[model samples]
Target: MTYFNKNMPSGVFKWRGANKWLLMLLLISSNQLIAKDINLATAINLMLKENPSLKIFELRKRSLDGAQYTAGLNPEIEMGLEAENFLGSNPYTAFDQSELTVSVSSVIELGGKKDARKNFASTKYGLLDAQRKINSLDLISELTDSFIDALATQERIKLAEESVRLSEDIYESVKRKAKAGAISDVEVKRSFASLKQAQLTLKGEQSKLERQSVNLSLYWSEKQPQFSHLSGELFDFGVVKEIGQLHQNLEKSILIQALTMNQRLAESTLAVVQAESKADVNWSLGVRRIEESNDAALTAGFSIPLFKRKRNKGDLMEVEAEIDSSRAEQQIALLELYGQVNEFYSLRQAAIEKFNVLENEIIPALTHALELTKEAYLDGRYGYLEYSAARADLIQSKKSLIDTAQSILNYGVQLERITAEPIYNDTAQTQGGDS
Candidate 1:
């Protein structure tokens, strides 16, 4: 006997089929049951751990550290065995007249060459460290921007979903009025068209959200995002710093520090080159054996180059030129950073003003107008066109608000990148609540 039944409700099967998509929509609509709830600080820490480019830079720094250990050491000692007066005479053929010498030779650095080389290597290592800091800052800024974009896309998706629901409600109302002879069939058809457009907009926003998710995940080298949604507020406005404060912190920026390190590296290199101009002495010590006399003696000698100035003039001049170049580059970098800070600061101020007007005034006014239009349409005092126009205006205004908020975040990230400091600290919530 089999216990099987096929007489289940069609509604149950329909819901079962639709449940997967519904779950996905719910996940996108809210931050619930997420696999990972990453905020700005968490994301940055993850990138620092998993980002491939950052890891490469760290490895390079370690390699430079290893090179520093050998910088101050003398050259390897050369060992040799020499035999003279062998096979030249009958007595030498059997080793009676043979002479053999065993020797070791090494170049002794002069003019503090060892110390200068060590200093140069130390400076180079410091420059690498500075470069790694700059790279990390750049990566963090980029990740912040991408994370904000993903969050904004999520908000847009919610708005699109709202638009779809609104359109559906309006369509149902138009259908009811048409059946009661209060509105024409043409009006019902127009309402249905608006509903379809809203659905299309929702689909488009969902697609955009997926792309933004992929972009954010790319920061940590993940090809696919593990989390279904980002959990952060997009409209977290904070007090903007003054231009003078940003300028004052400019010296502390990783880029400026890197440039300063470069200048020091150039100076250290010049010192090494100047030290190289003094010739190093090569000295040898050995034991010689004279088989004919059957006696052993010790020998020592030293030699130094006579034309040190002519030999090293080119190298010294090249390093001098490099020092001049590094100085000019450092100055240029400072000026460029200042210009960037000012530009982002001005833009941030503008974005804040725009966001305030849209969030505080325009959006609320439009929402009220939309409500009034909806009531008028329900009473048959307004046409489908007017209702749609009002709804469209309100939706556009809301999107504009999101855009302005995104701009604020973008400018904030740029400011952070320039100053190597947070413009808006993420405290797990938006400041003053979500716009």
Candidate 2:
């Protein structure tokens, strides 16, 4: 304390500026570290390979494989040993009182029972496989949705930035005019308010973009989080105009494929029930030894059910009911799919038309109007309020364009998900058919 004088530059004081510079560098590095960057295809691949649900499906497939193997094997193999007093009263003389017998039995299934069982297992396995594919398609759909959300948030963030820049420009203009006595204090105040609002909007959108980026990172490569912005051109909005075979192409939908597979599974189950109604034969074999004899004799036998409870009717009816339910469900899913495709297509079309109008017509007109308003304000032919309103109209037009672009992309993603195809893939042909 005695050495610390007012004129002396202490060690801490000397390093304070360096420490602040280092802190600033650290913050910039931290921001760079947390940014999430992703591309569309890479995101889809991650969802397929890295998702937890896909792992579950793989485990289920392994279990079904085991069951399928077991179904194809023989029913049972039996072995047994027995001890008995073969002689009534004679003991240890010519004939001993004890005897031992061993027996073994193995079942041989007939009447296509084993085949039916194997087929049942195989069908179940096929259903699971189809289920796995459905899972993939579903995951892809979720990825598409997330990807679109990220893109939309990104576009919104850009628009927000633009608004902030425009606001700042307008504010500076008004401030200069006020200093030159060409405008009143009210004009500067209004410009300041608009600038502040723009800044707040930009901050809010940036925060939302950060959240969407975090969500997107879950399905992307590890390096995606470091990306701060998208680098691709925005999707052009328009109809393909090759919509002539729209109804025919509906057959390519993932929802339709899943429904069809489910219906087939129901039909296979009904076949299993019908196969179960038929009688099954059982067979057995055994060997016997007597104390009086030195030889052993083998016996073989087969038996068929003479009569049993006729539960086949109820079982068949149950399977039939399931088939009926599956059919109904399939129909319902088809209807919903059709409705969704139509709805999204309509929305996409409208968004495209609106975006086109804004980009080609509205934006140009707004710019002209804004320029005229600015000139009028310079010549004192317009009030500050009128100039500000015209400027706002231009911003609004740009915002509308951004919103329409986002809407179109959103609908495109939805269509892609429903169809299980790339939205812009022109060469993909439909597969599968009506059952």
Candidate 3:
């Protein structure tokens, strides 16, 4: 079975013969299965809870949380025992002549390495947190787009169905006129052709809706959609923010914030590398046994690595280079974000203008024209060809209106994705009203 078949309710298909009787029996015994209704809020909540990618980021955040503790920890103590001179010369053969040494040692960090490490880890943790937020924003953006797509598909299906109905009506009228010798068989055939085209369009739209349904289900890692349909208005217009306000709000965007956090993390790592330039001191304390004198004494010493400058210079350079790279990336991201906001804002305005013209002018005119043509055809003043053309025009105009409305909603979603906030908010309305 196809993915669509698996997801679809069984009630959609008819059973044959004995299976039909069984279906009737079952239907009589219980209520029919209905698809669940899903809204935007419910869909987003499900994605947040069940999206696989978001869960991966959540696990990473937890792992980094544990790593933060290890970052600031000191080195572990060490212990050693030696019988160094026992195996040398004649004394090596005698246990009494053996010199034994036992010691404990640990490195004491210098140059504030511990503090630097802690700061670096803290910065890294902050970066991870920002990354999680970025992932969340991305998921939400994707889900929002998919939801809008599903809604558009629903609208398209409605338009297609209406077109099919209009075509069927025209075909029936053409047949009636042909039988009365008022129209030729050629006109009836043209009507039939238009009907077939409308049917194909409806079928295509139905297939698109199924695919869209599956796409929405994928967001929550479901094999099929839980809901039969989405519930929302397609042309529900909301307040749009000013361009300046949207730019200012870009700072709160997860992408931009993550970039800033990355820059800070690089700088913190540089500090850590610099702190490591001063080598830590390895100090040891021990008790030594002198075999000849049969006496014990305490010993203590410290050691440090040489060539610190050359050893750390490469790391310092690498970190410095990364800092510069991060800075450049941040600048690029800012420019790209600005461009995205400007582009979507322009497209949104254009869509709004187009939708207004179609909704207020073109659609109504086409609808009225189609109605007049239908009446004229029924009264023998117009022919089937004229009626079919008018019907097709009306259908196309309605589809165009739907497309424009979807464009406006999609552009709004794109803008919201970049800003990490709703561009259309109550505040926009309040401010605009006051002005």
Candidate 4:
């Protein structure tokens, strides 16, 4: 990057300390009264609390809790009563000749069916938890993307303002030179045109910032944005890991965990279906009364499911196929994850290199060139066209720096989203070990 120059406007340099806060406040317009600045941490907290998509997972967990309860309950008992032979014939029709029976019955599950069902339900909970994490990561990734866009826009607004400022200065100088007859009137017209274009660009960027801010706030359901600005070092991406290092942590992604959980849930379902294949028995014990003998006797009986039934055979095959499908899906997901990691890793490395060259070489050179061009124009050694070209080159270089920095941050976010781990490894952000 160019060395901080004593003669350059303060806006060209990075804002620091109190000047940063002053810049933030000055950026606010008269129309915004209660607006404040927000950081990434605050945006994340608001998104987690107010995001609508996560609420469904909470409701689904409640529904599964009910399913687990239903799965654990035993078969319900039935009560039955029967009377016969009271009204049909002389010997068997009257109440004294009638036989009466009362019974209680229920199905007795076999093959540990209840336990298998309970395990099946319990296994779903683990799967649900994993899916929830995946959804959360997805939402967080989106929020971060919007936050970065808004922050980048904020930085662009500053650059646009700087451009307008320099354009106004050039326009004023050219007008004075035209009045003194040192410069042609055509130069004044050209300078004025450039100044107008710069003003328009500044306005356009400001409008873009408002839209970006609204997008960031909408994640938290705010129709009207509360924060006038998202404050951060958008240029500072910190130390990033190499593509190979990022690949090693591919298993850490929530997507991989979710796939493993799916396979497990499928396997657990197979167990439940296997348990179901073993038929259960229905049984009853009762008291029978013989009116002719005026005596009571106990009776007991049981019936089993058709011994040769094969209805569950189809279900077992289906569950086994599901397990196979889940395994295949895991393989596919790993490949996709690897591909995504590689894409962002390569892109981010290139972006970082681009940013360094712009910051250290190109911008500094253009800044010095623009200063020299302005001096030459004033001394009649160079034309206004040369001065204008230098100013445009410097402005474009600064814009490139901002855009490159934004690209670097976006690539890092994508890598982080893919790995479900921090892609940025700046020492300052790392947590200290427990004492």
Candidate 5:
């Protein structure tokens, strides 16, 4: 391995600190915005900045850096002095009992091993950074999914309410006709049955909306989670980019990026394991003083390993196997992401097509049919069964439209999460004319 000069930019040292700071700044600024309405992106940015999990990862990255700094420092030098007294006097001559001597000692690295340690530490730091990015991306995906679910639940509630309204209209009409003796008691009972079914459906939808609201409140403010205002009107889908083109741009995909970093980290780890097997030499120097003779002595030492049986034959193989495993996993992750994106795109295409047909053709046709059926019933030509069927058909069609719209929004969210890019040009956009 090669070493980079501390003063120069190196291949392994492209400097992640500057870029990390920019990401931090972006998160911080987003969190500081007024808490009016939290969009999906803003909520994620805020969570990244403030979440405890992300903060822990940030601290872990810093600790690894500290380790690198400590490993890169040169071994320290030391000095000492010693003195002692002789208890007995000499017969022929007098000897100095107390004397002091000073000596200096230093440890010198015997090989280019200090640099190797530094390189290994740097590799560990790089791995920590990669892990941090992975965690951040994961958080983003979860937040997006949760937000979309809340919005979809809100739309479903609106459709349920419309169904209830239709049921109420039928119930009132039948009750009036029964009072005039123009309809049988059984017809009035059927209308009451329909109204009860609709009310039950409305109740179920209301409960779902509340549950979804509670789910969103965990990540966002209470006001933001209560998505009661979303109408069954068409939601803005924003600009539609071709799914094929987006799949081709999978290089920017988040899961792929994480796996790629993991592969590099595994390779780096293998290198570290190999480097560890190399022997290290430690040298030391010291001084010693004799109390009775008033004499001084100096000492120096060095150490070297004589065997590497365990490291070379056992631990090294383990590291090699780990690297191979990591490579395989990385490849697998990439394939899975590719397949998932394609599936989501296909579903999105189908949902969009169905939504279009319903909105542009089926819904309008159903509306006209309902009006004509009402007029026919008033003219006393159509039976109760045909009129009731038309009403139910219209209700079912509106429900289908709402469901398809939700599916489209959900697929859009998945696309954004997988790609790590905004699917829509702006957040305020509705799909087609629905928004």
Candidate 6:
């Protein structure tokens, strides 16, 4: 289940930034700094080029290549020599009547065992290739989630700055009113406390952003982050397909395809084991010399084991069970994946609904209400309490919008990963050099 995958020779991860692996190599070799903001594509590029786990796939692939090579080989011929009728009874004492023989021998494989071996080896190699790709896709999905988290923190920092400014303006207004005896000292202290809280929140968000940035870089072992920021959109989750259409395409995803490969590999292994059940024919040809007759002749012999199939019953049974297990595992994976797809889809829809309400209705209404309340407070038509409530409502709604957008993006990433549906249309955020 934890099979690792890597970029194939064709570099198929173009969209995931596998094309940038070479560029990453150059930068690392040159000791050049990464000054660009990290994004989805860049993060993938770094993971492909620098992650230790990814490199393991390439090495394992090379080992399977060797297995495929060995599969094509034929049985080796062996030579033997024997002498008889020497140093025995009186008539056959010494070498007086000894018969000498020289022979070349080897097994003649039966039951197409050679071909079965080749097929099994090739299938195993191909299965490894398939697993590598699926693992890569999974890795990219995880990295996307982390990148979105960092981007979300960045958005929150912006919201926090706005909150700080609003808090400062309210505090100044409250002080003016208090100086004129329009409000009590209690209101002044409350406004001052609100300003300090806003500042503290802004500082906390900045620190959170730094930590998230470091987390993103950890995918490639660059724990000390090189990028100043992550450049993906936190609010824009692009378009989502109806769950039905997306689910329909799930079978074609690389993840599901890998299951097919597993089944094929298991079946091929059964073929190899079944072939082994029939022992190969061992035969020999030789030249024999008879001293008594003073003549030479040709001699041949062969060996075939009895009930050879019974010897391999255990192996055949194991392989057959593996095939069945593979089928069951595929069904399990599909079920789990489908469940995840539905869950993420539902979560994404709910988050989107909340975001739209804030973006299109609630936030606008709150902003307008805050403005009116501030004017009323200045004109003595409303109290400082009303103005404070209005201001708090607007700020809280704005922060909620950022949080909800993050949720949408995170859920979108999960959907894209399982469904192979592109939901985060923020690819334009990738930058190579400094940004």
Q: Pick the candidate with the highest TM-score.
A: 3
Model 2 weakest lDDT span, ten residues long: 426-435
- Candidate 5 collision pairs: 234-434, 234-435, 235-431, 236-430, 236-431, 237-430, 237-431
lDDT (Cα, 0-100) at 21 in candidate 5: 82
Angstrom error at residue 275, model 6: 1.4
Per-residue CA lDDT of model 4 for 1-435, tens digit only, reads: 333567879787754687667656755643355448788888888988998888888999999999999999999999899998888877766698899999999999998889999998999999889988888888888888888887878888899999999999899989989999897899999999999999999899999988888888888889988877677888777777667878888877788888998999999899888888898999999999999999999979999878423988888889999999999999999999999888887788788778888888999999999998999888989988898999999999999888888887787788888899987655544211101
Q: What is residue 386's positional error in candidate 6, in angstroms?
A: 4.0
- Candidate 6 lDDT by residue in tens digits, 59-176: 9988988988889889999999999998999998778799999999999998888899899888887778778877777888888877877787788888889888988898999899
lDDT of 2 at 187: 88
> Between prediction 1 and prediction 2, which has the larger lDDT?
1
Which regions in candidate 2 have their CA more than 4 angstroms from the true location?
1-37, 83-100, 221-224, 238-241, 292-296, 422-435
lDDT string, candidate 5, 367-435, tens digits: 899889877876777766777898889878877877787778778777876777765644455555222
| Clash list (residue pairs), candidate 1 | none
Give the Cα error of residue 144 in candidate 5, in Å: 2.5
lDDT of 1: 0.84
Against the unseen true structure, what C-alpha lDDT does each candidate score? 0.84, 0.71, 0.84, 0.85, 0.69, 0.82
Which of 2 and 4 is the better model by TM-score? 4
In candidate 1, what are the lDDT values of residues 197-243, reduced to their tens digit? 99999999899888887888888889998777788888876666567
Best to worst by lDDT, what's the order?
Answer: 4, 1, 3, 6, 2, 5
Task: Write down the TM-score for model 6.
Answer: 0.81
Task: Estimate TM-scores for all models.
Answer: 0.85, 0.80, 0.88, 0.86, 0.75, 0.81
Over 4 Å off in model 1, which ranges? 1-36, 89-95, 221-223, 424-435
